[model samples]
Target: MARPTFRELTAQALSSVEHGYDLLAPKFDHTPYRTPDRVLNATVRVLRPYGPFGTGLDLCCGTGAGARVLRAVCRKRMTGLDFSAGMLDRARSAAPDGTWVRGNALALPFAPGSFDLVVSFGAHGHFLPRERPRLFAAVRTALRPGGRFAFPLAAPARPGTPAYWSLLAFDTAMRVRNAVWRPPFVMYYRTWPLTDVRRELRAAGFGVTLHPLSELGVRPDGSPRCRLVLATRLPEHSG
Candidate 1:
């Protein structure tokens, strides 16, 4: 499918994030915003040793990209949750076998320990830094004792590189646009640094670890190009 036109993007941008996603739902898979299959596949590879999980929750499961990973790893059930009704509508169709729920990530509707694993992809930019605590805590709460919450994180673009400048410019534009606009769109490419995210996850009581995704290849510096953040909830009887 062709990308959303300039008019479509403009309209989406001017509206609230939920409504914007609602408008973009149909074309989301074709857009760069959708999580890539390679990223999803790499994450699945990284999570395999940790899983054979009983049930899984795909937090912010827009278009169900992460559902593929959950379906591959989870034994009992897979659920896709998102705040955008339209996105959930698409995800329901995309991953027909999975349960789809419409609700905010920060305010999960499910009971505590509802899932054995929780995974999210390509949705962090939608959340502000201040929201991480609530989001992480909610995910932690949603997991069963000793359950895992994991997501992929790539190294940030190096300074002075085209990718770096592009992200900087994009974030700057978003900040300016939000300052002048109402119902601000909250996406930012550079907001999720691994250090900050690890701190937030730790604060939320997750025993966090990083799994290097070798399948995704290595960086020029020999580091894995992407790493999966594996944050595990403590078992009830653990010290």
Candidate 2:
């Protein structure tokens, strides 16, 4: 299938959140912005060796993309959680077998040590840097001791490429929009840098590791353009 044009996708993205996604939901699967199946398959491949996890959760599981990944890795039960009713509606249609919940990431409804594994895809930009520790801690409290929370993080855009400039413009525009608009549409491409993310995860009681998705290939600098960040809660905390 031919991918949707960038203009069409951008048009939907710029509208109000619910209305924008309600419009995009129908064609979202055909867009590059939808977590690529290659990335999903690669994540499943890496997670397979370690899992057979009992219960799994997909946070901000837009259209159930990460739920599909968890379905392959988890053994018993799986769930997809998101705040967007439009997104959840699409996700429910895609994965009828998995549980779906609508709620905020900062205060997940599950009790402490509830899930064995939790994963999210392409949802971090919706959160600001300061909100990360709370988000990570919430995920940690929802997981069992030694439970793993994982997600893919791509390398930063290179300084002068069109991709880089495009992202900068988009983020700048979002800032301007938020200044003039109400209930800000919180998305920024450059805010959640990986180094800052790692520190926040550690502060949230997780020991983190990085695994290169070598299948995605390397950048001009010979570094992997895509990698997974696996953050596991420690079994015990030191005083």
Candidate 3:
């Protein structure tokens, strides 16, 4: 796949989240925004002990990166859901064996206790911090007791570092762009901090655990560069 041109990206940046993804769907894999294979592979390695699940879902499964990971860990059905039709079309074509559905993440179009494993990749930035509770509640409702909701989160860059400034600049620019733009694109690099995310998951009826992805390497500070958040849904009577 060829990379999207600057004009194409500019157009996408100006469009609504769904429309922007639809426009970028064809060449999304060629971009750095796509989840890298190492991340997917490492996720598979970590999930193997917890899975071989009956059914799996890839929430916000842009172009099927996470769905492909499910294929390795899940024994039965594999489904991918995204709000963008164009992205779903590409995902369906690339992985025809899996099912693809178009729906909003906030209100997933699945029955309660429908899946045993759910994974998402590179789609968290599309959601606002306030919207996380509703989003996580929906995921919890869709999962059976003991089912898991998993996603990767990287360590925050240290303050005053070049990487830190770069992220701060990108988020600041996005805030400015959204202030002037309609149907704001909600992509913020610094929003999904691990502490807040774990608290929200616990409140959403999940027992949260962090598994270090050492294959991705560690920071100079000796912390893993990335960790997979495994939030298992608890039974109704359990906390």
Candidate topping TM-score: 3
Could you give candidate 3's per-residue lDDT for residues 106-136 as a string of tens digits? 9999999999999999988889999999999
TM-score of each: 0.96, 0.92, 0.98
Score candidate 3 by TM-score against the native: 0.98
lDDT of 2 at 175: 92
Instruction: Specify the highest-lDDT model's number.
Output: 3
Tens digits of per-residue lDDT, candidate 1, 178-230, equal 99999899999888899999988887888899988887888789998789999
The runs of at least 3 residues in candidate 3 whose Cα sits more than 4 Å from the true structure, single-residue gaps closed, are none
Clashing pairs in 2: none
- Model 1 residue runs over 4 Å out of place are 236-239
The whole-model C-alpha lDDT of candidate 2 against the native structure comes to 0.86
In candidate 2, what are the lDDT values of residues 78-157, reduced to their tens digit? 98888878788989998899999988899999878989999999988889888998899899999999899999999999
